[model samples]
Target: MSDIIDIASKEVGYKASSGNKTKYSAWYGMNGAAWCHMFASWCANQADVSTSVVPKTASTTTGMQWFRDKGRFKTKGSYTPKRNDFVYFKSDGASHVGIVEYVSGSTLHTIEGNTSDAVKKRTYPLSYHTITGYGVVSDYITSSGDNSKGKNAKNNKGKEELNYLKKILDKNTDKKKKSKRKVKYKISKIRPGINLSVKVIVAHGTAKYKYQVQEGMKFSDERKGAPGKLTFTTFADNKRKITNGDAVAVIVNKRKFFYGFIFSFSPKTDGTLEVTAYDQLRYFKNKDTYISVNKTSTALLKKIAKDFKLKCGKLANTKYPVSRIDDNATLFDIVQNSLDETLIARGKIYTLYDDYGNLRLREPWKVNVLISGQTAESYDYKESIEDQVYNQIKLAYDNSKKGTQEVFVVKNSKSINQWGVLQYYDKVDSKKDIKLKLKSLLDIYCKSGKTLKFNNCFGDARVRAGCLVPVTIKIYDQKVSGYLLVDKVTHTFNNSQHLMDLELSGGDFDSSY
Candidate 1:
């Protein structure tokens, strides 16, 4: 466990790289926004705090409300700010937040973001007028005591080395390779009897919004789609109107870009339509349903899809009994929860999307592309120990027939020695087949001792999220190459360049795995 202060101190001098956007924005899914609250959330996330302890948000008011709701908040003058607590204040009639560094006498020191557009330490008197309250985060703080002093010194050394390496790479312009591919994007409206394409202005989507892997790719409680917008012109007559709930498609470079549907559309005076679209799952979002079953998890899911007239594919055969489950949730809720356990146990994932009005559920596809200096414009590499790589997992499940809870444990002793015992727990039915499944999962994910994230920008319009791509890049004055599984991808198109921001994980090139 890492101390909260230690995690935050490492990023004290952080600043926005462009506009109001800092790398910390990625942590809260809000770029180009005031980031004081985001900085605090990022620190909590790095400390591995549960959502119940610290609800994730970028808005200052939302963060303060979460702390207050949890009874961890006290009025500013009512309590002295402690180390690792969140301090909320009103600046210019707007709320802002920061993480408390320490308290000395009546002076409260804090680490805040968006303060003069950079992260820096600031001090204030306990009775400052702008102060609102303090959120106690001491319960979530894990300490190494004086041992953290040594770790901080070692981290500073790593930063110095990284800075020196960056200088060397910046001077090596000869390594850059020129690309010959052209960039283009177009939006298409596909209905029962027509297909139309138009020039697109801008397109953007974040996996954190609607395509979240952990949340079963469903939109937020207050939203309906993965949240996407398109600006385009319709040259045809106003006969066929592209209205809400209409199935639409986006194409770039003569390829099927996204299979989605129109959420809302507005026509402009210049004969253009600003259409908002989401993934195909938006079509069945409001279908309320009920199920009371004593069936296998897979069987129950298939039955739900069939009753709803939905098409499902690539159903892997892993029979696990899920009995006496009664719920009044939607069809999506049932299907998503049925497979949630498998996802956590083995990293297995499934998606449901409409393929041109045909709803389909199946495992996502992988694309293997060899990205090098010639095909990529810019690339960056990041590795962090906070990713929580597990080499051992303990599974506990209730055996109603046996009247006891059975345990299944799997471990890699070599990994435990090298990286320590990173542990995980899962609730699964006690079956020999399920235990075998857990063992196979540990063997695959336990090989890597650290988490490596690769960010690459290239001109490939075919690259999409969930695709497996091989990367070969030189960083830290050394060549780091590996095949990474793409977690999220963003396609940015413009007149000068077509760029893709890809977040990739898994697979290590520096180790013997």
Candidate 2:
């Protein structure tokens, strides 16, 4: 074992005193505080490592920054761990600060402080998701020669490092910069072993970097029809930085806002790059002939996604089974055909959307999402009777037992008088209840098309199409409030600000032909 690892290993079984006080924290003059990073710094100091090589900070964030600033850090899958290397782990939770004791093939035997309130030895796979990256120590120039990369630095210039470390310790640790460069959007390569070691391109609109966003992300989806789309462009250092077919994800305010695959892009003469990406359903737009039997919408979506090698997330079961044949229908049309049949028969709404790259089929929310004045900056509401509104529904069925044609009708007299004779006609199964089916169709069809759109709505990272969102607006001395279906949403991230434009519907749909 290396001297750094050996020194850290001897601290095994060391536990904090009452009130979480530890020798490392005490050495750093911060008793009762977290000391994993302090423990690493202390170990490096005992081994006479230079402050320039290994930072003497008690904060993991500070340590990570120090390593990142020095160009000595490698994200997991990009580098192999060696003895004496410091590794970082897990985000959105208690992160890790561990020292590698040894590398045995694919496993990393590590010695970490404060693993269960004590110094403990642990083992994990080299490709574990919790591992963020490693901080490599450059080979140190010592009296024994240059062995710093693998050898512990001796006290050749210990006095200078001690003074440097003392200066850092004297500073106010609580002092922090208000803004730092962040990688809000991460576009990664979509292939086998994704998230393990694949290449990822990160872009940001940080004011510090001065790369302002010229084009923001736009996303839209039909409730139960076409595939959703996520498209945007940012500054690219080189044309090869982003290639068509690469996977895309937009992380807004630390949460996922959109996910898809790149399909097309164009580069400007001034180095600005414009690109377009679409969800898994983009493949569904390809026309193909397929016949389905005894399959629900969700079932057909999953089947087609699997057949096309697309990833599938949660697919909620749909309520209706449909049998149909399309000579040459776009894959999306086939899925929509099933969705139409199911909703018409069962009066249920099922949505197909990509949830952070994995395509999902789910039912839209029935409950309300209350949107206060603070939530929406401005909104435009439109109600129309000219298009896609009917007051009467007529279904013609052939009765095999009676050997005759049957006509079923359900109409709203109030709607017919107010909106004129707007009739919807379709064919139905003779075995089903004609009266119930006609009434269901009438309720769905006999309504004015109402659409509400919100512009520059405070960006909610969780908001997306196919979900229910509440909207409250007071316009023209009229108050409108309640839940509405999100038909489309576009998020604009510019100058370090995040906003979205949304088009909402009141579950308005046209009957299946």
Candidate 3:
């Protein structure tokens, strides 16, 4: 007999080739519909079992109904879920379903599909309130952890006994020897205009550097994409000296060139030098300029790119009508503030970054790669539902000459019912700006119900900041499977392993039932 859990486990890292479209697309007869139930159906098909073994359906509720019709459905609290059994949940409605992988004490390990955009395994306690019921497969018995069959069983036992004795006698301690080599790094290349190259040497054994870039800003700050330090050991015979504002580029995680510039450099105690640098955006942040004008958001973005000698990347198409703005802002300030106004007025999200010294503004939408339970060696997940969420938003703009303040309101009553009237308020100078701004605000805040902090996982090399990715986690006793935005990503490669530390956040998705 084929074990369904065993088969499902083999497919742990399987994912959709494109957005929400998987190999099971044809089986479910839908291109991008939620396929958690369909995944279970496909697993059943793999076992070559009749529907009597596990009723096949694409709807989570429908699957539960089918089990009820068979007189096989039992509520979770009343009946303990066993390995290979189907389980369902109810949230805002019937939210999600999955197959129980195994039960360990009060915890249930499950193999689920359509979680965080791929098939994944999750853990939940028996007391998780969202569980609806468990559908038992009448004819399928759980595996006993024994693979031996027929006359081979006795032979396998004899071999195990012999192996145990041999292991005891041959034990010479399997501890691996630790290497004592000094860790160091080398620069493979520098950008074309940087104009200097020299042998790299560090004064401190473990030099520290950090960089951060955020979604809403033209130039990164100390908090995001801020530059750390680059120290070099100097010699009196050496003719070249690394100076402030010189461009430095190095490979991170063997992924791509992390380009930055020297902010400051100084001689250290023993005659060596320590150079501190910031991201390329630091140039814009430190440089000062002023301009007073009436311009569309796109025009302003293009201007900032031109002034900073950056190639303009993806520009949002919305020609936001902004007028009569003060010019007392820095180059980076204008870029960030204007971008914010545009997003609020246009109802879209954009990211600004120094792409290899080229300034680019792009919407974060592309699904570069998949991160699944099997692919991740280890991971840390932290989610937040902060003041960032809103079920209702009120936008007020004053038409000064007209002697009236026009107020536009947007509300998701269904969300309010669940989250209550978490209201937000904003004021503007233009009445024509209220509806569009409120539309964008509601779209951003209402949808982004939760944010995530993911760390220490091996991710696809293509994964980067501003990309869309799906994630699966159990929160508050429910399986929260949904897509998220990779706001910030740090890649580190050591000991032949690539580890990705991610700051992921996303907008509203219906919780799995």
Candidate 4:
């Protein structure tokens, strides 16, 4: 036997002995239930085989279906037995695990956990059907030459004895056809990211088997004709009936433009055959750049060009041309006015300064606002805040009948405040409430909540305690406006660099004035 099979068997033995009810539970950190996947995972880990173990919650039927979909291995009822393979039996809303020992004709000898008490070896008849598909752990097999000596010799001797018994039980083969041996081939492995060189041994018959490798072709230029023709050939053909000391190869060329190799055999028969086709193309990171296009931004740019009768060039090829009358100047104007209203609603203070470096307030005094709150210091925290507060709010607003809510600037003659407005009362109230709703929403979107922080305020925006300066909160509305204010504020900005201190209060009113 190969090292991989020995390792797999040893792992199975260890797991079977470690509490039959919870065999291999340490792998998944679940100690209460019988986990067949955990058992498989543990065995694969020992065998040094890299494979993903689906969760125990996955139905036995689903796991069986996956094996069936592979269309490999033999089945006898519900129990398909193979060396180093996992056998799952339906239990109480879950499944049980077992390891194959040896096949006695149609009867399978297996080592199983929690079967008739603890881990034990038992012989199950082939008629005890319900056999899910078999799982082949590794393609490596022991050569007939290796088994001709030492401990393997004894095992072979035992196997020969068993084969004799099997032959005695079956009395139907004709003596004339006995000279024509049966050929069997078993697939080993397919090296990924390159052309496949499949290896298989012909067990009987005339050892030569024709192999063909085909490429999935697409017409590169249909206007002219097909690009090129493809040809396949067998690399090696070892004549004479194959036993243990023989090997055959089928080489496939993997060109950069080719998709994958499609392997086939001539005169397909019920003989054992191993074929592996490698996927030449892999998931390249740069390919994602081609798949991802900022469609919304592209559409918006096109719409702007059409509406204004303006000529727009490709972003990659040219710089944004500046106009005497700035087209984007209106956007800044809208943002400024909205910021003022938002500030007032949040009960915060802000000052608007014009382009000439002059305060727009009537008092013309540099007012200072002191903000007290914790600041978020990590990238993860900031990202979580944005995902919660901004992204969630935007998504909710977009899905609502009101379309997108306008973030307005609350402004009085003396002060400006920034606040996000929600048209309907569908959860969001305070920052804490918003964070909670965002967590749930993010979980729904990402299918996992590990990326978000549950409860943590970002930070206050003031440079020093009790120190306030002339500030203006720029809100993104349809237009910009200015307001002036003087106050002491305590607020946490989830994700902002310069504008953190400002709490929204019900008493503070939002007005354009």
Candidate 5:
């Protein structure tokens, strides 16, 4: 809350030693630069609001842009000032920034750095024309305590955020120790990136006229938070009813696969048309700042869709409340981060996709589709102790009173011997249960990661990313069977053939359909 004001106030009487050198400028990597924004950034950091409520920057312009991007910026004279909010001033552009200390009706009291070679208390009229704008800092609620109008919240919000951070520190922990029901299917071998396109390109180079407009159409629907992209080749004889910005649908055998607007179409050297279309999810690529208070992920999505004038459909109720500031984030990243919070806190995965032209948010998709190797294909199955697999959990807490660092550790001797002491380390607040938390983290991170991919499976129109499909395959004398979330899927279609390649995640299988 008002902690920023208090911290900045303490520095008000401190003068730069010389050569524009100050503690703030030194920490910001520009020891000799003007330090007003750096001073504000340092104060916000000490207040634990930097980048969460205020931007961390050395340039006042960048900080102003951050507020504007988050829609938290108010032009000068247009807004009533509040504690911890930023006051930016400009001659030509934003040249200086300060922390608001108090507002008395139309008069403003502030603290600024790099002014007259020292930090000092400042006063100005609220309608000062030189004042460019104000960056709103909404998290601090100092109005509740001592009427100081500065400081942190004295409410349950702190506890909730603390718990949220704890959950993030222990993101790998699963309440249930059991894996879901397994599904066995044959698989296909795969390589990295554009498996289908690689083959078509190789074939075209050697076989000539392979995979041209005669191949019909290909559909590629990406997972949650990603725009659905459709790429197809067709002859002009098929009628050029589709144009840029026109709604385009891809259907084969009476099964509608992709519904989106054609963004671009070009003629290939082979006298065939190459077209690309993207679903409504494409719009979420827009970046903006969003502030939510006690709103569920689904509810927030609805609000965002409405605010952007996008269509929405079939949004599942995600009851976990998200109350935080996502400043200057892409809409896709905003939605994904919100869903990820639920995934970490409540162990639930949700999907946001475009159904036809309508934006849809759904719970983890589970279905009865079976993956099989009857199409004369195999798969690449890998389980390795590399990457995020840890056998030991070590947490440290600084003890200022004792002048020493306290260490807590939980380790599996067998895993340590086998995996060679892979450790997950972080600093925890003194209030945390070191032993219990470490044990939970050890259980979560001490396992090998299993990755499954198929490159030559027969295309099924029903298969798409973000959906759980039962997959069964054997690896190293172990029959791995479970519902796998399709991380990405690429489908290709020709006159006589349709094939898909899938990269799936083999953990936390959702049995709910």
Candidate 6:
């Protein structure tokens, strides 16, 4: 393992050095470069154990594809990444690469080189979202299949042999112990938002050793759900055997524990026999919980607001004298009662005028009913006053005809209370003059609309209709002024007379009109 580590480290250093000289100059010049990719390459190189130089590349996507195409990458997503395999990143392009140090859960914690900084080891979450793919580069051998070539090879091979010798020495030293045993185990970090399976190994001289898994807790008291006895058997060699799919007890220790789960194995490694246990667990963090709440709240609010707005046409501004309010009162009961009483109320209409005192011709008023008492004390009506006034103006323009056209329920006011003023003029005879005049009027109205301040009521003018002469309407103090520009050659006025007639004949406009 030591020899492998050294070789891997050297290979990573080489890659980092090369990358720094070329594409990673910025990183190398910094305090320290990132090591995510370099470490990965080094581990892969060392694991190969062969004399051939492992193929290295700059492209992350291409490198992963290369391995996959060769049938070297693992099929199952859970498989731990071994040394000497390609590490990939889902970046802007196939640009990042690294080697695997170890695989835990769905992520690969690796020591990679060639990052934003110089070569260094970093752990990254492993998933399709981050990793485009990965591939194996080499096994426990040199690429050339030659173990006896250069000085570096000889030195590395000698070190490897020595490490093997050390392992044998350790095994022999343990053999002298008559009560020890060996156990196989796998360790992994618990990941957020996922259930993890853990395998633990225990070994040697156990007098019915008890065990307990707790999240950041001490292994002291069984009464507190601490170290409890595990069920298992002693083998012929006096070794206790445990495998996957075993039930385990998890306990709690200290107050305010942040760690997910913790457990202890007793009778440390014995040369002869071992005990093992496996468990699956999960963790939930704060961010996930918050996101769920936010999404749900936003959706609900949008739905309610949309329905209310559709019924009200536009929200009225309290700053406008044209008072309008919406009531949250249940409409079902009201509609039923109105129908039974045969009570039909007529809608009020008013013409709208622009700041220039011209009657708006194109844009028509839209009628909306206020159910009563739905207004909130804090609601700002000024924000939507323009829309409400425009709707009322549109209603009045549609009612204009040759005779006196009356719209019902016109709210009594201090100015122009009896009826609205509808003025007509032939302006299309001079197209250029009309256009210039219209532009000048619009500029002034827009400026006034921005400058005027009204606490409860305000008004402005806007050009909402006509192709030739154009009509400009001003809405002020709940009264509308409509200006119609007639085309002298066509002998036609730009207005909604036809619409008003239809409404009158069909009783579409309130019968009170």
Question: Best candidate per TM-score, number?
Answer: 5
Q: lDDT of model 1 at residue 419?
A: 81
A best-first ranking of the candidates according to their TM-score comes to 5, 2, 3, 1, 4, 6
Cα lDDT over the full model 5? 0.68
Q: Write the per-residue lDDT of candidate 2 for residues 441-471, one digit (tens) a residue.
A: 5654577766667887665556667777766
Better of 1 and 4 by TM-score: 1
Candidate 3 structure quality by residue, lDDT tens digits, 214-233:
11111122212323223333
Q: In angstroms, give how far residue 13 of model 6 lies from its true place.
A: 9.1
Please give the clash total of every predicted structure, in order: 0, 3, 13, 45, 13, 67
Tell me the spans in candidate 5 whose CA falls farther than 4 Å from its real position: 1-177, 180-213, 237-241, 372-376, 508-513
Q: Model 1 clash tally? A: 0
Error of 5 at 315 (Å): 0.7
Relative to the true structure, candidate 3 reaches a TM of 0.42
- Full-model lDDT for every candidate: 0.54, 0.64, 0.55, 0.30, 0.68, 0.28
Question: Which scores higher on TM-score, 3 or 5?
Answer: 5
> TM-scores for all candidates?
0.41, 0.49, 0.42, 0.25, 0.65, 0.23
Model 2 misplaced regions, further than 4 Å: 1-215, 366-374, 387-447, 475-478, 507-513
lDDT of 1 by residue, 78-177 (tens): 6655456789996458588887766655677888888888888898988888888988764333332221131331122122222323433332322233
Residue 149 lDDT in model 2?
27
lDDT of 3: 0.55
